[model samples]
Target: MWVVAQAPPETPVGPEFGKASPVGLFILVVLGVVILGIGYAFHRRLSRFNRRRLFAEQHGIDPFDREAIDAAMEEAGLRDLSRTSYL
Candidate 1:
């Protein structure tokens, strides 16, 4: 009588198998910085728009009229410059 021998199952085992590469960490850090930059830009734009809206409301300029609002804001800027003494 003869007996058959079966080989053991193949499985991965090593120090490098589950480790993350440096490139992956670099990409993650770059992505985070890019997201933060976009958020900052968006925040600046929204803040400027908010200032425009408040200015229009205070001076009774029609908020929807872009040209009028811009003209008024420009005049206001000149008026502010004239009133304030810069050293």
Candidate 2:
């Protein structure tokens, strides 16, 4: 009885066997787009961080000093690119 209820081995047995649906393909494409977007955002944020760190280091300011960094960024006509608001 248990053998009778067991699944088929090595071969699929279904109505739409070996066929991929359009909806599944669409979900995969959407997931790819989402991953690309996240990667882009990460790269952008990292670039901004590097710029900010360089700026702070050049001017002898502490990298962790948010208030000073904000003031310097403002003085240089630069926006807070490291913030998620830019994304």
Candidate 3:
């Protein structure tokens, strides 16, 4: 039969105990490292996408600007929307 004991007042840990078990500490460290690695990978991917979007918005003509696109279509001799299937 398991016997229940009353709690001690002075900190649950006794003076004899120096540190946590080695295996427990090792597991905690490994978990922390894995979490950090995953966070870094996600950060890098987001940064790359942000950079590409910024460059496109600055240098490339806005695809949403219908007037500009129409002007370009006229210049390329593709003014007819019905004939230009690529558009």
Candidate 4:
């Protein structure tokens, strides 16, 4: 009786399949930076809007009116100053 010989299954090569390549990692990092930048910009815009809204409410003026905002700030002795002060 002749017996048939079976070949072993081939193993996958190359540092495991489905791993992220250098280019893919770079792309992901770039995407993350872009997303973060967009989020920061959105946060800054929202914060400014909210600040204006709150100021208007406190001063009983129209939030959309720039002249009213300026007048209110002047009346309240409020000035825009940089956070970092030089001595």
Candidate 5:
């Protein structure tokens, strides 16, 4: 009597394995960290702006009045508004 053994069928690989290599995973983590840092900085800045706006509003002052800012800057002899740029 002779006995034969049969092999099982193989499974196909998926696409996710190809897209996410070790280097790609590292890059994605680094990019996420940088984006998080930038978002935190922007949030802090916005919070400060909101606080200032609220204070101005409480004092019956118009926060968007550029003339008032320019005049204050002129009185203080600080950086000129014409040469300064916002981030």
Candidate 6:
């Protein structure tokens, strides 16, 4: 009697597999945008803090004093536009 060897079946490639859908791509893009936005906000806050610290050092004031920093910024006319109203 003779025995025969059989080969394994190959996996079929289709649109549903091994491909990113439009909705998935959109979600990824949205997540990336959100992360970037958060990073930008953090950077802006850090820069503002640094600037306030430098200003405080220049004027011989405590950098951690919120009131002093605000007063210095206000006295220098360097207030953020978002906090001021022009009516």
Q: TM-scores for all candidates?
A: 0.73, 0.74, 0.46, 0.61, 0.52, 0.69
Error of 3 at 52 (Å): 1.0
Among these predictions, the greatest lDDT belongs to 2
lDDT of 6: 0.78
Candidate 4 lDDT tens digits, 1-87: 998986668856686767867999899999999999889877766776677688889878988897888777778887633222322
lDDT of 4 at 1: 100
How far is 48's C-alpha from truth in model 2 (Å)? 0.7
Which residue pairs collide, candidate 5? Answer: none
Ranking by TM-score: 2, 1, 6, 4, 5, 3
State how far residue 4 of model 1 sits from its true place (Å). 32
Q: What is the lDDT for 11 in model 4?
A: 52
Worst 10 residues of 1 by lDDT: 78-87
User: Which is the better candidate, 3 or 4, if ranked by lDDT?
Assistant: 4
- Please tell me which model should have the higher TM-score, number 5 or number 6: 6
**Could you give candidate 1's per-residue lDDT for residues 1-87 as a string of tens digits?**
998887668856798788899999999999999999889877766766777778889999887877777788788763322223322
Better of 4 and 6 by lDDT: 6
Residue 22, model 4: Cα distance from true site in angstroms: 1.1
- Given candidate 4, what's the lDDT at residue 35? 95
lDDT of 2: 0.86
lDDT of each: 0.74, 0.86, 0.61, 0.74, 0.66, 0.78
List model 3 lDDT by residue over 18-61, tens digit each. Answer: 77788998999999998998898767666654544454366575
Candidate 5 residue runs with Cα over 4 Å from true position? 1-20, 66-87
lDDT score of residue 23 within candidate 5: 91
> Best by TM-score, which number?
2
For residue 72, model 3's alpha carbon misses the true position, in angstroms, by 17
